[model samples]
Target: MGELIVIRHAQASFGSDDYDRLSDLGHQQAELVGAALRDMGWVPDRLITGTLARQKQTLRGMGFDKAPEEHAGWNEYDFHDLLRVKFGGTIPDPVQHDRKTHFRTLRDVLREWQGGGVEGARETWTQFSARIASARQAATREGAERVLVISSGGAIGQLTASALGAAPEQMIALNLQVKNTAISRFIFTPRAFFLHEFNATPHFAPKERAHLLSYS
Candidate 1:
């Protein structure tokens, strides 16, 4: 069976003015993940990444020299926008900068968004799920024996949950747990797609490197 290796992009500049770029630690995490994958001989026959800068940067840090095919479907939902929309055009200060409060609010907002409670959301829950499905179809195409994809935590969580026929709430749980630079794998054929692994972070298994593991 063909294999698809999906990697969530490394630590982004959370709470910074720009959250789309990877942080210094994120770069290190990406490089370590790349080295670990290489040691396992899990090189990809094809590479794909979202249009986001963070996704592209993660792929580059992975040390793969090939040009990756860009897919917007792999991009993350606009959480900042969602927060603003949910709050009637202005994000609360706590949600804007405090990690705990931000995620707490996010969880509630996601539930609302899923149930069509968050008005003016740029993309509805249905649309977001549909795009992920479309991206999976593209990634699982017959030509490549092994495909590597660089995406965000939200997209990865949604995809995995969808693959398992799990509830949307499970996606939020999975999304929160996915560490930066974590890897998830899938085995696929034209008509079959199975989750082989989820959120494996062998690179950070060493005690010294354990401190490097991060989510958000």
Candidate 2:
């Protein structure tokens, strides 16, 4: 079976303007993940990432000079658009408040979107899920044994939920828990892909890099 390694993009400029750019720490996290992957004796046969700057930057930061094939299907849903549509152009700022409240608000928005409540969403939840499935098919394409996909948390979470045949709400848990540069593994056969692991960050050992672990 071909193995697919899904890496969530490294930490972006969290709480900063232009959240699509990778922070200095994000670069460091990527390097660590790259080194850890090499240490595990795994080199990707193929590299894939979304068109997003953050996703591409994370791939570059991973110390691979090779160019990756861009897959827009792996691109994340636009949170700003979702919120604006859901709330009639009023986008809420969660950073000004507490963590619990921030997460609660995001979960609510996802729930609304999943239930088709987001009034003007360009891509429905079904569309997003279908996109993820397309990406998976491409990942397991012939001649690609060890495939690496660098994408955002939401897209990865959607992929995970779809793989497990879980309920829509379960995706919120995957989204909330995925860490920056985290590696989710799957064994891909011609028929289906089995989840080997989800949200594993072997690179960031608690004793050495506890502070570097970031969810955003």
Candidate 3:
């Protein structure tokens, strides 16, 4: 049997010029996750991440001196571009909108994409989902008993949801709730993979570090 840990990248620099980078708190969160892994006596035999800067930075912040294997498949879907194309290239400035509105719009956009309503997408929903599946198939190949993957919420959520044969809405819901630096675990054997846990924040305890817990 093999085990896989899928970790969402910590809080990114949302509303910043470069949203791909991790925030300061995100670095702290990444370090805490590394500390928690040490506490649990868990040492991953393999590491993987998307090409995104936030994912790479998080891996480095977790005490790794070497870079993990990078896969573009694990990269997040372009939600900003999705919004633009869906809205006929006239996207409303997100800064003017509240969190609720943003999320609500995201949810609707995701649904539209899933329903084949999104035109001009870089990749269709089927292609995006297939990319994630391919990443998993590659990661779970033989010789790896424990694998750690640092990815964005969308990729992690989609993979885990598919593992459980979840409905489309359930997958969307999972994506929405993925907290930064949260760990989602899976049990994998030669034939199958089962979700063991989702959205776990074992690192943020003791009240003071509670502020480190973030979903964005």
lDDT against the true structure, each candidate? 0.93, 0.87, 0.88
Q: What TM-score do all the candidates reach, one by one?
A: 0.99, 0.95, 0.96
lDDT of 1 by residue, 27-78 (tens): 9999999999999998899999999999999999999998899999999989
Q: Pick the candidate with the highest lDDT.
A: 1
Sort by lDDT, top down from the best: 1, 3, 2
Better of 2 and 3 by lDDT: 3
The full ranking of all candidates by TM-score, starting with the best, is 1, 3, 2
Candidate 1 weakest ten by summed lDDT: 112-121
lDDT of 1: 0.93
Instruction: Write down the worst ten-residue block by lDDT for model 3.
Output: 91-100
Q: What would the per-residue lDDT of candidate 3 be over residues 62-121, giving only the tens digit for each residue?
A: 985544788888899988788878788876776224567778898999999999989898
Q: Cα RMSDs of all predictions?
A: 0.7, 1.5, 1.3
lDDT of 2 at 110: 93
